[model samples]
Target: MSSERKKPDIQYVNTDTKELVNLLIQGYESIANKRLYPADPLRLFILWVADIMVQQRVLIDYSAKQNIPRFAEGKYLDNLVEFLNNTIKRLPPQAATTRIRYTLSTKRETATVIPKGSRSTVDGKIFFETTKDLVIPIGETAGDIEAVCTVVGEIGNGFLPGQISKIVDFVPYLEKIENLTATAGGADTESDDSLYSRYREALSTYSTAGPEGAYRFYAKTANASIADVKTVSPTPGVAEIRVLMKDGRLPEEETIKAIEKLLSAEDIRPLTDKVVVKAADKVGYKIDISYYGFKHGQLSAEGIEKAAKFAVEKYKAWQSEKMGRDINPSKLNQMLMEEGIKRVEIRQPQFKEVSDTAVAIAESANLINGGVEDE
Candidate 1:
């Protein structure tokens, strides 16, 4: 083995270093107080505690040594800076340097570059890359525009840092804030009742016609119209339309035409109603209509079971659309089980029960001699 001497590890003064460490901790606290703590309060607390612990360890190690290390001195500071730089260099590129990448297109390239330093020192001053583009394209949504403004503001403030930037890259931080608040507050799609109420109010406000009149006019003319009626797989052409009407008869030419006219004119689309008539010619004339209706004389005891299954599926879709929410699977299963039990009970024939002589005899025996003891 080679007899090469190893380098001596640097040591420090425990007491003085502790005091300096405390000062640094206080400084960090002050910085946090002024600049705002991290969004994750737990993470911020953990970081503070960890930093303090590390400092305490350093102080303890330094104080135990014969000669104390000078941390505040220029030479020590330079060494510390070099160590930090070395550590940073050793880290992954993703950990060390941050990059902001975006396609430079006519639609996207409108980034505002704020020059670093004042006008007096513009020549030699280093320019930092700050502020991403915010292009409010024509006919963008209010929320979209709001989100864009938020992203621009964040980028301008140099808040887009490394991995964090990846998350806040396309989407705005403010939008995330809004979403978090919305989620916490349980804000979702509007309810059917609310939609109905709003529509009713709107229809009622129309001049020369009440809500009822409007509804009738729409239902008869525009709302009722259907187009592109076709025979679905495993279903004949005639039965498809008949099942939708629930009248057990094929739709007439007049009926098809009426449905087409109503749908086209009123712009009413009934998602629930599967039966549809498509326009074949000009003036919105409907020809063939398709539906997922039950076949004639096909439903029996077995067929009823199949129909029940279909009903459950249909009910789920209906509830989801109307309530703007989905039913919990566990709750649905329990409900279905209870309903099945109730249905079975309902099917059972009721009969009057005669008094059992044997039970009466047993009760009488129990009453005698303070309830008979077993042998």
Candidate 2:
């Protein structure tokens, strides 16, 4: 979930315990027509009562904040989104899916059947099952079938081609099973931040004229894993929507098609607009940098080296997470310095501009630690 946007702190009422106690004591003195000392029984009773009032005030503030979208969380946030005019709802977790190829030992004389729900695995801990039955025709040794993860969410994502080759269910004449495409589209339950962002964009959906924010809202609603979207109109009546998945992964073909279908609906788009949906293009860059630490710094030389390596990884993640972010070595240098590095030399990625429809990705990384030197 995106944390770049900060929520403002809001409170409905004052909840200062000390101030509440003083107020209570003052009221008691005014009503009783006498001063109440600190050690007196009445003063102690007032203090106890003041504590309870403070707790209630704090709860009042919390409950009031839940009614606001920017401060809501959990089920409260879900309810807040539903309050939108378009009946927006929180997105649920989705499973990763890919195509698995079943190879027969030899060409079948008649036909070979791979039943629906046949399971395959890479490490045996997680499983992917065929979505439908597959029939291999005569003279064909293989057939490809769509498979979905048994468990939901991102745990089943990123399994590369040929990685899941082990078949759990026995299929007659099956020689091997392998995934043909990388698993994609797995995502956890929608986070509060992401849902709120969508809720804001959903405000534009009330317009039948099809605004840019309206298209962006529909594109993001297509998949839970979608992190960023850019909408552009290069020509009159032509609307192009670019989608970027979470963690810098490009959207799969299935995701693109889903977005296209949603945006092209008569109720969603204007009559004159031609809607197109596609994955955001990638701008590849490499990370090659050397960092040094101060000799008199708090950490030892070994500690500084470890910290510098971690900083590089963090910088790479930060740079790639957002669409249209430039390839900037200066950000890497700043991160390294923040991690106690005395100096840094970034030699690979110079500052390069990236278009709104493209994302900057680190193709590879090589970080060198130059040990410690005088500050």
Candidate 3:
């Protein structure tokens, strides 16, 4: 996009409390022919008006930028985000989910009700609730009962393996049933930048032979969290497709099947080509950093650590899994330096590059202050 097409930064300065108070006092003094001190009673009303006006301007500016930032507040923002997601053929990310499977006891002969909105607990976090009613017949068990139950809150719902051992609320005869292993989906709705980026990709590419421009359209089908996609023909008329999921986990069988089905259709893939789909391999990274220097004028220990960690987080997000990507340690060190840290050494990722068939992801980061060692 050209500079003219981009949203320019709005720079209107909203009046602060002091400015509002001074302006009002000046007008009052001009009309009454007397100066009033800051202790005047009417000043409170001025301050109140000032605060409300400032808040109004803030909301106005935020709403105006919805076309750019894509972050919304309250109900309007929620609907906008949802609309964008639906346009992209994926459901909005749900909170943490756990296995809330149901099974009829061997002796129980009748159908049992696993009522809707039933609640489960994973200690140290919020409770998870079922979305719908589940009917378990005789011989029905865990995964067969239903998809996993999700937590009421999104923050603690991810990566909870076998955590829902206790039941907080359920319909009668719950003790006779079994709750199988629940897994966490661990995803957030695609960000505004990600959505915008994908749109640009779609506009730019077409699925032509060798160039493989149109694979993005197929990769983004329902339930597919495409991190990266690569197509290769190991043999004539056979396109070997490897899909890397966004969260670095293997794509579900249904998602894989969907890709195969979509690719097989004559409208998308060539009629003569045989397409095979598979998930990419995940390679985990743990980065340990040793850096020297204070965060821009920050002298305190905690503040320094927080500022430095923030810079590392920005790097991590930009570097997270994309296919055919390599770990650039020099870029990471430079990024930290830009945040006012120097003399850096990246300890993890001893390898120079991650293969095209593999997706590189980091599990954890270890940032050490290194304490002003010789630079």
Candidate 4:
């Protein structure tokens, strides 16, 4: 998702109050067959009517814009997607999940059963519950089961192993419980920009033949966390889909599997097509720059330094948010200049071209502020 494309903002009808008032005055003069001065009661009545007409015109323009996919929002966008229910639908918020390990106090004589829906949490604010029961076979000390967050969205993500160790549910003979893997795959509901992008691609899906756009659209629909998708046909009958998660994170194995299964469906993919889904590779880069502020500028040296540091962080985020974005030192310098810096000297990260199947990530940043200098 690149939102670089410009969307049209059209004014379907003029709602200028002054223009509407003039038009109403002209109509009144022609219908009454007499001149109407500004002081006349009839003229005042015409002004009031014009105000109402202007409001109606505004409503008309708003309604027309809502019908357009580029301009639609919220419920209006939902309605537009409903029109293509057969082909695509809006995605809901997804909960984060992680594998939890359950250990017994001792090697049990018989099987130890951890019931489904067992709850565990690091804090009471967020909870994770097992999706299925875990059975430690006879003489086994432990078993692993998958657990999902009780809440949806990104709030439940980023819990490292052992972060969630407290067990809320009582299981007889259970000694300890911990997360075996990091929590991931949580995402918010689909955004308006994302929905519009899919709508444009869905137009190409009417044909059974798998075009690049159609494949990309289906891949995006598989997961809400996906930020960008690149579809290519390396061979005659093979389609490869490369996925990039939001904030430059790679998609987990579960996310890749979900996309693979969705694309491999008999109705979704052509019988001759072999679909492969994988995460986009990352290309590492380092940001090393020194900047100075103008000596005679309004701000103090401390203020300028703070602004420069914030700009560097913003640049790093911009660089990693999109796939195939080249590592451009010129862009970094420009961002610093716009923040009231007098000059910038970039040392590392000379311009590098990133492939469509890869994204550039800034592994480390070295920002040196050289105090103030003459303009």
lDDT (Cα atoms) of all candidates against the true structure? 0.28, 0.86, 0.60, 0.86
User: For all the candidates, what are their Cα RMSDs to the real structure?
Assistant: 33.4, 3.6, 7.3, 3.9
Model 3: weakest 10-residue lDDT segment is 143-152
Candidate 2: residue pairs that collide = none
Candidate 4 lDDT over 173-242, as tens digits, reads: 9899999888887889988878888888887678653888888888888778888999888898999889
Q: Give lDDT tens digits, candidate 1, residues 209-257.
A: 2223332323222211111122222242211111111111122333454
Each model's backbone clash number: 17, 0, 5, 0
Judging by TM-score, tell me the better candidate of 2 and 4: 4
lDDT, candidate 2, residue 228?
91
**Local error of candidate 4 at 266, Å?**
2.0
Q: lDDT at 110 for candidate 4?
A: 92
Lowest-lDDT window of 10 residues in candidate 2?
Answer: 1-10
> What is the lDDT, from 0 to 100, of the residue 306 in candidate 3?
69
Task: Please write out the lDDT profile of model 2 over residues 1-375, one tens digit for every residue.
Answer: 346347557778999999888888888888989999879998999888988898999999999989988888899989777865547888899888999999999986899989899999999998999999999999999999999999999898888899999889998888999999888767899888888888888778888627889888888887888889899999988999999888788887756777889888889889999988888888999988888889899989788978898898888888877788988888898888898889988898999999889899889988887777886
